[model samples]
Target: MARPQRFDTNQLLDAAVRLAAAAGPAAVTMSAVATEVGAPSGSVYHRFPRRTALLAEVWLRTVESFQQGYLETIEARADAREAGCAAARQVVAWSRAHPREAALLLYGAQDFARAEWSQEHIQRADRGNRRVHAALASLAAALGADGPQATERAVLAMVDLPLSLVRRHLRAGDPLPAHAEDLAEECTAALLGSLPMAPSVSGSRH
Candidate 1:
């Protein structure tokens, strides 16, 4: 008889993500994950008791991946103004690369998920939002769109428009509509075009 095996949580989680990506979240079950990870069902149960918990974990992991990559993209921008534009473009690109994650997110981020959302998930989302907000704020300032305080409309306008358009492309199994650059430029211009160019902060050497 084979010895009872141990399951690595990371491995389990990784398998769960892949399963969900390939077969949708419904395909993620303890038995399914156990088979995918080559572990016993008992070992899988030792880690995740309920399907909801497992699904949530998978969704959370996807969210973390998105949050990390997203911030990195915006942070790479030379200025907030550029960050805004970059953010829009990055969002489209990210959506294309991770359609499964994006679909999972769209379903789970609805207001109804509040009842089941874990605090860790909430905190992670809040942190991600702050990064997004800050980047948007910076863009607004750079564009001279700041009115008394930060106007997030630019960020909202920029990302939301592109994301929705990209979502359509994913829905029909079609490629992302138009080149990323062309779509990004059109959205950025329409959203941030009104803001004045930031006056050069000359002599303010860090």
Candidate 2:
């Protein structure tokens, strides 16, 4: 009988991601992943002793890559205010472009039963989310959108608009049509317009 070869960590992880996307995380067992990747189950067990290890790797890979893109996009903006607006726009574009990745992250992150992550891993997750947050805060101040309350106003206002729109296009099983830009523009305008204008003239009479 021929001996079996071990699968590399990346290949196993890729299989895990694929399995999760297709059948959710429950399908990501060593046996299933090995079958998915055409390898022996022993190889997966050798690489990841516990199932949590594999899940963590999959979550970390997805979130970290996304965080990098968000950081780059936010940092590249010339104006903090524009950066904030662009951040919302970029999220819509990203969600539209990479809906599966978004879905996986949403599903993975929500499971509180997941393992305790490493400090470095936790920091990476924070860094990914904080890009949009910091940019939004800076932009809000720069554009007179808010002072301390982000969730009730700016964050709430912008996030759901794009997310809901993305969900609609996705559930319909259709690519974002060309006319989608019109909807995006209208959403962007409504969100930006709804922000409270700066306190009028600071010292002017009411």
Candidate 3:
């Protein structure tokens, strides 16, 4: 029987995530990840093939992990307004729980040399983005604010705003406050409340 592998793909990616979070994407070299995990460089190379693949995996894994929870949060609530608020709150809560991963996400994909990523990696990133946009569009329609402007507002209220809150604290290396979730939910509620309701269609009586 073959001996089980000691180091796996996720373990190496986790090390890369930590390296990127602590310094920047530039710090996530294959040798650096191998050293961080105390694994042989061959292990890292075997999994990633090159530094570009390693960087792509690091960014994609973190983002996919985050989006899974975020999408679930939005879907869990029956009420669109409440769902939007919960989604916002989830952002802060997730960041608080996974500060290192959150820090890594603070940098854009471009910072991870996204231009060098493979076609498969680019497709993976695009699919995640499309899923997020579709979810926000559904939320906007449920809230009776399905116009382009309203959908944009929904994205801001539920996604961008909460990320900004996390970004500030993560960039400063300060722990997110206990009230961060509440603050995020409150801000989302406010923005969602201000959306212009779509006009109702009525049948004319002959």
* Best-matching candidate per lDDT: 3
How far does residue 142 in candidate 3 sit from its true spot (Å)?
A: 2.0
Candidate 2 colliding pairs: none
- Deviation of model 3 at 63, angstroms: 0.3
**All models, RMSD in angstroms:** 4.2, 6.0, 4.5
TM-scores of the candidates are 0.74, 0.74, 0.92
lDDT of each: 0.68, 0.64, 0.88
Candidate 1 achieves a global lDDT of 0.68
Per residue, candidate 2 scores C-alpha lDDT tens digits across 105-146 of 547564522456655656766676786576555555544565
lDDT of 3 by residue, 1-206 (tens): 99899999989988998999999999999899999999999999999888999999999999999999999998777677778899999999989889999999899999988999999999999999999888877777776676788878888999999999999988888999999999999999999998754443121100
Better of 2 and 3 by TM-score: 3
Best of the candidates, TM-score: 3
Candidate 3's displacement at residue 19, Å, is 0.4
Model 1 C-alpha lDDT per residue in residues 1-206, reported as the tens digit of each score? 98755677878988877776566666778899999988888888787776666666677677778777767876676665566676777777777787777656555543224446677767766787787677556656666775853365675656777777776766666767558656775777676766666776222111
**Ten consecutive residues with minimal summed lDDT in candidate 1?**
197-206
Query: Can you tell me which runs of candidate 3 are displaced by over 4 Å?
Result: 196-206
Checking candidate 3 for backbone clashes, the offending pairs are none
